[model samples]
Target: MEKVILASRNKGKLKEIQAILEKFGMETISRDDAGIPEFEVEETGTTFEENSLLKAQAILDEAHTITIADDSGLEVDALEGAPGVYSARFAGENCTFEDNNRKLLKELEGVPEEKRGAAFVSVITMLFPDGRKLVARGECRGTILTEIHGTEGFGYDPLFLPEGENRSFAEMAPEEKNRISHRARALEKLEDMIREKCSC
Candidate 1:
């Protein structure tokens, strides 16, 4: 089995990636497991793809190995893609998930159901120590609920629904969501790329 480095400090993200890649028997090792020092990868870029590349390249520089980095966020149509790149700190610096979700709901209070269309966008960038790189993106489109729902998942999962699904992302179990999430779609694309172009 080939080991890949997922350059993220968030444990939730690590678990999510692990579950998604497990389909291909790809195992991921985070900095926590590898005992590598973690550092801030400033998201100076304005797009998820750019930020994903930034993190993957930074980690590859240090580890000099194959690495995968993800950058994702909720993009509300009404907000003109707000909280896209700024998803982590939408409320402000040091913001909590609730803080961001609350502000988003407050802004969409009067919007009609149809107008609340939103989607989760994810970009994954892979960097190989040999100076090769690949990027893939995926999205799940749906409307923003008037309020939060469910008790699973993280970030904006509670309010965002996938098309044709009555429940929010947060309501779905990890296994269920992993099968259809924006991250899952992107990972599937990444897996295809790995097999076709970067197979070890």
Candidate 2:
């Protein structure tokens, strides 16, 4: 199987990516597990695509192999798409998920359901040592609930209710979420591109 280094330490994310890429005959491993030297890859980009590419290039430079990186976040329409690139640090640096969720709820206080529209966005970038690069983007439109609803997911999953669904992401199983998540959608596109290039 082809090996690819994932430029992230989040185990959940690694698992998700692994499941998606497995069928493509790709083996995904975290940067730590791949024995890559740890160096801060600062997210200085203003957009998800830029940040994803930055991280992918940083790892590709170090490992000289195919590397994948993703920049994803929850975008609340009412917030004017705020917490975009800053999603990870929305509640200040090193803040917990609860802290960020609390802040989001507070920000949308008094906002009706109709205006609570939001979307989860994922931008995945794959960079090869030979200077080839591929980028894919996916989005899941949903609404922000009045309060957190489930306990199974991380970040803002508990508060996000996808369109045509009654349960929040946190309420669904990993398989269920992966089947319809923004990351999954992005990976699906990436898979299609790969298939087209390889004529598989």
Candidate 3:
């Protein structure tokens, strides 16, 4: 089976990516598994696609392998898409997931439920050693709850109520959330691209 490197240190993200790629009969490994040293790649991009490319390229440069990277965040329509690119550091650098979620709720304070529309956006980028690149984007539209719910999921999952669902993402099982998540949608696109390349 072919091996692909996922350019991320977050275990949750790595697991999710691995699970998706497994369907293609490809084995997924992280940078650490490849014995690549950690180095910071500054996300100077103002958009998720740009950031995803930056991270994938950074790892590809070092490891010279097929690599995938993703940049995802929550964008609240009422907040004018605020904390979009800065979702990881919404509350501030070094902030925990709870801190960021807290800040989001506080910012939306007094905002009526009808006005709390938001979307989780994910951009996935794949870079091959031969200079080939593929980019895919996905979005999950929903509303941000006034308060958090569920104890599962990371980041903003607890507060994001997906359309056509009463439960937040954090309340759903991992497999259920994976089925409708922004990342999963993006990965589905990526899989199609990969199949096309292989057939050609």
My TM-score estimates for the predictions, one after another, are 0.88, 0.92, 0.91
- Please say which candidate is ahead in TM-score: 1 or 3: 3
Q: Candidate 3 lDDT, tens digit per residue, 70-189? A: 999999999999889999999999999999999999999999989999999999998888778889898989999989899888899999999999999999999899889998888888
- Sorted on lDDT, best first, the list reads 2, 3, 1
Pairs that collide, model 3: none
Q: List candidate 1 stretches off by more than 4 Å.
A: 10-27
Best by TM-score: 2
**Can you write out model 2's per-residue Cα lDDT over 102-189, one digit (the tens) per residue?**
9999999999999999999999998877767789899999999999999997999999999999999999998898889999899888
The true-structure Cα RMSD of candidate 3 reads: 1.9
Q: All candidates' lDDT scores?
A: 0.86, 0.90, 0.90
Worst 10 residues of 2 by lDDT: 191-200
lDDT of 3: 0.90
- Each candidate: RMSD to true structure? 2.3, 1.8, 1.9
Candidate 1 structure quality by residue, lDDT tens digits, 34-149:
66675788889999999999999888877877788999998999999988999889999999999999999998889999899998999999888777888989999998999989
Candidate 2 residue spans exceeding 4 A from truth = 19-25, 198-200
